[model samples]
Target: MENPPNPDPREALASAHRTFATEIEALRALDARLDDSFGRAVEMILGCRGRVVVTGIGKSGHIAKKIAATLASTGTPAFFMHGAEAIHGDLGMLTAQDIVLGISYSGAANELLTVLSVAKRMGTRLIAITGHPNSDLARNADLHLDAHVAHEACPLNLAPTASTTAALVLGDAIAVACLESRGFSREDFARSHPGGALGRKLLTRVRDIMRTGAALPVVRADTPIADALAEMSAKGMGMTIVVDDARRPVGIFTDGDLRRLIARHGDIRPLTVAAGMTHGPKSVAPGALAIEAAALMDSGRLSQMLVVDDGGLLLGALHMHDLLAAKVI
Candidate 1:
């Protein structure tokens, strides 16, 4: 096989410009066509007690999958069903309480029509997203969203380019509208996506990942400098919490403080932690968001912090590395 020759820069630029212009005009047309039907589509999905079933064939199917994902992540339960598979037992997934979102540019795809028919027979509501307003699927549907495009981005206007983009944007519009109506929140999204980094930012709390109880490195204010150093070494967090007789954190001695102390006094075994520790360091409650902790550490240019209670009682210790381990950084 041989590689193709390079394209003429002038021709390439012209082609790119035409494609973008066509798609932009198609989008403008779609916006102008938006009407009460859009509101009805949103209401249909909002009123659905069961999951939103998204079905389509070809390029629309790809868009349908994305729509289903957006709907599911943003609090509306949704799933994608391939149009071809609907009659081959996938239709069993539909229920009377569910709502069907059918995507087809022509609004007359046989595969999608069959799926919509089964949905109607099962007492499910049908919402059609199509370029043709009067196609079979649109006429049969309970609600119709016209995704009509002036022309495809392809020069011949035969490909599913502009129409697909319009469909995708329309799907996003519907999803976002439903999200706002349902009061979809960050916590709700985090709960649905617990394994992602954004989920860690929202769902993970100081108590969930902070080193607590025996895992915390602690030393008394009266403890010898050498003993405090030992606590830091044993814990491997590069710092030790200095507590009063009541077990409340009075100060924190970090590796940086130790360096400064050694510069002042080479042999500090005789010194107590109170003489070297930084007093009243910044701290967080157990319920604080992990991202807030990260921000506190970042703003103060710190690596470690004491987790304290309302009474300043030492509850746990957290380090920058802990945030890294929790994927909060």
Candidate 2:
């Protein structure tokens, strides 16, 4: 028994570089060959009344699944149906209103051909993505999208490397075209991905995280600066709201203000909060997005913000720490 020697790192690097170069050339060929057929393919998907059922076999099946997910997340209704399964029972997933997107570099996989036959019998429109335009799958398709690549990135030129890359990129382009045509918005994307960070930032409202009731630190303008500081400490918001008799916020005093006050007038025992409080503090409506509030606070260089009603009555407050805790930052 003998241990094998490590291969040369330079050789591995050279092989990788060659693979990338081959794939880049394949993609360039795909882009240059694009014509009115590409636009028509997007138009067909958009016009489809039912879901886009993506079907494929083997390696193309994995790419089909990714394409389905991208289309679904971007506002188009779509799902992947395995080509082999479709001939057995998954063909029921297709309907006359649905559009079939079949992926096969050779355009001659028996399983896909079976599914295509069934889809055609059901009157389902078929969009074929194949490297051979004259293949049976492409010739029989209602619309053909040629995914032909000059060659595979694999040194043997037998693996589905560059061909798969071309198909995946074509699918992505179709998804993006549909997304723009439908005017898919960030909020819409967030809605689809509610458990993700972007969703939390877009969907969280000011009222959801603002401290209200006893958690709020409130003081009258006439209150002593020492008492306002106590309120700030008690609420742990690093600030206190100075409100009028009607509960309308007239000013705000923060830890920063306290420091500036001590520097200006050392004898603060006789001073009122009004002397140190900032008049007309920034405020937001309770319904505003928490992310928007964060931006407002950032632009004003604030650590805390007041949430007020339309009548200017203080309802709640937000601390920078709150946004961080909620992961909205």
Candidate 3:
């Protein structure tokens, strides 16, 4: 195949600018026209006891899929069902307890109309998002969200650009409203996205990443500095906890302390661990978030922090490398 001639860069840039302007105008119009129906839609979804089944066709179908994902991740139980597939056997996924949110730019797609019809017969409530308020889907719906745009962003005014953007933003508005109404929190979101970075930050506790048992470098306050150094090297944590008889952490000594001790006084072969250990070592509870521990370590310029119980009994130790290994930093 032969290569086509490149379009003029200025003309291409102008076309891009026009598209952005049209979409911005459409969103502004949508924001101004939004009214009580939006609140009503949120109320209906919140009152629902089951899932929200979002359905659409063609370009509207793409928007519907994203909206469903957004809703599901933000605390509203939802999933997308393609309009054509709903008629083919996917309709079994729908029930009277489910709410159907249908999207069609013209509100006249045969496949979407068919799905809405079956949804009505099943006694399922319907919410319609479309550019046509008087269209069949809107009229039959329990609530109608107007997604009408002045015109398409396409120069020919035939493509679905501005209208689809309007529909998508409207759906986001509804989902966010429901999310706030339900008191959805960051932890709730993290629970739904355990494999994502936010999940690691919010769901992972210090106990999950702290080194314990044989991994912890621990020593008695009166232990020889050579023994403390041996324990730190064996644990590979670059630090050792100086604990009392009750297993409560009272002080901490690090490689930095060792270097400072050497600089202050050469040949300290008789020094005890207590001679260089920092008193009142910082600590966090086992239940605290790894991210919180990371913050404390960062602000205090600490490489190690102790985990303890209410009675101050040391349970574990957190190294800076542990937070890095857990991807909490």
Candidate 4:
């Protein structure tokens, strides 16, 4: 059989608009419904002596997993337990000091009750994120967070849509509140995310990664261009810093400059490094973040740079490759 024609683009766009409008309204309603109960939930999680265990069935399970991850990443230690699996054997992961968070949009997921009851009996604290306050999950919970929405964005009103969005936003609110309450800083966040570009930006500094002292490709301003090129070749940084007699940086010469000079004339060995170098090239301090070094190199279209102290005296040297090797780029 042949397929029918697709709907009009205008209709498709209108459907998207409707869905966004419905979910946005759901979020506004949820915002109005917030009260001391929300604050109480944050307080319980903050004071937890053990990890927070989050669990749910179906769509709520996905939301619960995300909430658990956000909580764990933002300073609260948390992990998700599958609701159905918890009854089989996964409940051993929970302890008396733990807090169990169960999510149920209808407030009556059967798969969640068995494990919730077990956690309750073990003296573990229970928090419920539910759509119906009087549902079984809520009645059994120590604290209830209402995630009720007026309607689903789904045309059939059967699928989880606005309700899930509300639940997710509420989860984010809880995580951020917990993060602020615990005094979580960017540096602390870096420790948890040490493999990403953000970790390099926050944790890796110029001094830690820059080549210092003898490792620097350096020469005096009046040094022969051939000698400057030799220093760059020896250091393998593709560039050399030109300093005055006082050891203060006056310019920088790069392989690109060499190529330009060679392209213009063949016998360039007689030229002084001062004549071929870019005077007053930008430099960064040793204590700066390596990401800052990346910014300088990127904005100036440079491959290498000099590291100088506040007095403009050469302290070290670095190249864009250094930032790349450190993953700051």
Candidate 5:
């Protein structure tokens, strides 16, 4: 009996490395080709009153969808259209105020050419991203962006490897340029992504999640420990907010503190909330994002925080669990 010889792992690793290096070199060459036409394409998209209609066929269509999503998420409204479908009936989705972005490696995709003609008839501005600037699609476009690469990353040199990567990068460049021209802020991005965790972090303020008014388990500094405990139990927040006579948060008393108080043989009826409370518990402004409050609670190892207004008046209270349920953390 005998064991088989092991394959050379080094050869496999070297082959992958070489492919990546070649593709990266292709991207570098594409970067060097960026010029005034790229700037003009961005300016045209920026001035578009309607959505940026991105159309391509096959592999380019997949890339166009991603590019359209990036553009929409970053404050530039955009959507992907299949070049073949545009000729069927989807061309009606476009308007004269819109800008059309056509993607083709050969700049001669028949489907794209058909839609390009419809776009022209509708008086829409056309921007072409292709490797061959002299090709039909590019020559007919109002602005032509040359995304030529020296060679494909594929050993066959026939697949849409380097060319697709170049197109994706060029689309990203256009999106970022439009974003800058429109002065799209982080707040603007947050507004468009309100259902995601990032939106919760940037847009969900403390007041939006805090338990306010009668829902807050609050006790005055002079309130007896037994009364405070009753309020905490009734509110089911595991803690009670301690406030001064002026309704400003002064301290906090939690269930853990109650255990310590009992261990000390304290008289619960005579002890005041101030006597058993941890002074100056972490607090946040009502206008602060809930995520910021969650960070403060996590970093400080606290379970809850009091929410206050500008003048230090108690607005409400927030718990770590509330943030978890809201997916704000």
Candidate 6:
């Protein structure tokens, strides 16, 4: 049998573009409707000491989870609760100090209505994000954020398309506003996401990752080049710290120094660490953030750096590889 001809790729792409354009128009309509109620929603969330419990049914539930995740990661304490589960005893997760955000397109989702009523009885503030402001959920809510869209992107106008996007965007706006109102800092965000790359970049300090005490490779200024190499090898770091008589960092000798020394002369003993060392090599404060140290290493083309105190006393040493191992980079 002869095969049927394939559909035109350009036609398919054009159809997809039309869908996006329609939805974008709906989103614009939704954005225009944002008003005083949006501000009230943010205020209620900021006033709550406990978590923001986001509950929604159907497609709104998926958006709610994403909003909750964004809020939790960005300094606001929040979690998603399914509207159906709230009536099945999960309502206990909410308290008077908490705030509840309910999402529903029709604003009459039976599951969400039940949860909103329970929150009201518990004296928890309720914020509603819905397409219908006159809907039951909106009427009962302490604050109503109008998420109404002109129409759905779906040709049938049944599946959630523009309305879901509007709800998601509004949720993000709320989270961001609350974050700013609370003066949330990068360090504060790091505290909540300590196990992630962002946390490592912001929270890891030089003192936490540097080699300390005897583990640090150190030698006197007058130590022979061979002794410096031994110290470097013993400490397993590529560099050795050269200290003055006062035991403060004066210079540093590294594998590069040994290569230069050997290129100068085969004799190693007469060439002291002070003679071959680079004076005042780059150093960082013990309290410096690990990401700052990483940036320093990159910009300065340094493989290792000595950590020092305010008085310039050697506290420890840090290698670029150490930052890599700690996932700070």
Each prediction's whole-model lDDT (CA):
0.91, 0.94, 0.93, 0.90, 0.88, 0.89
Q: Per lDDT, what order, best first? A: 2, 3, 1, 4, 6, 5
User: What's every prediction's RMSD, in angstroms?
Assistant: 1.9, 2.2, 1.5, 4.3, 3.8, 2.7
Which residue ranges in model 5 land beyond 4 Å of their true spot?
1-9, 213-215, 220-222, 243-251, 255-269, 278-283, 295-302, 309-313
Model 2 spans with C-alpha error above 4 angstroms: 1-5, 264-272
Writing each residue's lDDT as its tens digit, candidate 2 over 163-188 gives 99999999999999999999999999
Q: Residue 111 deviation, candidate 3, in Å?
A: 1.5
| lDDT (Cα, tens digit) per residue for candidate 3, span 147-254 | 999999988999899999999998898899999999999999999998889999999999898888998999998999999999989999899999999898889999
Off by over 4 Å in 1: 1-3, 263-266
Clashes of 5: 0
- In candidate 1, residue 264 scores what lDDT? 95
Candidate 2 differs from the real structure by a C-alpha RMSD in angstroms, to one decimal, of 2.2
Better of 2 and 5 by lDDT: 2
Better of 1 and 4 by lDDT: 1
lDDT of 1 at 70: 93
Residue-wise C-alpha lDDT for candidate 1, range 168-274, written one tens digit per residue: 99999999999999999889989999999889899999998899878788998889988888889999999998888888888899998999898999988799998
Using all chains and alpha carbons, the TM-scores for the candidates as numbered come to 0.93, 0.91, 0.95, 0.79, 0.86, 0.90
lDDT for position 241 in model 1: 88
- The weakest ten consecutive residues by lDDT in model 3 span 260-269
- TM-score quality measure for candidate 4: 0.79
> lDDT per residue, candidate 4, 1-329, as tens digits?
89998999999999999999999999999999999999999999999999999999899999999999999888999999989888888998999999999999998888788877888789998999999999998998999999999999999999999999999999999999999999999988987888876787998989989999789888988898878888988999988888888999888888887888788778887888877788888889999988878888889888887888998888888888888787787
Clashing residue pairs in candidate 3 are none
Clash list (residue pairs), candidate 1:
none
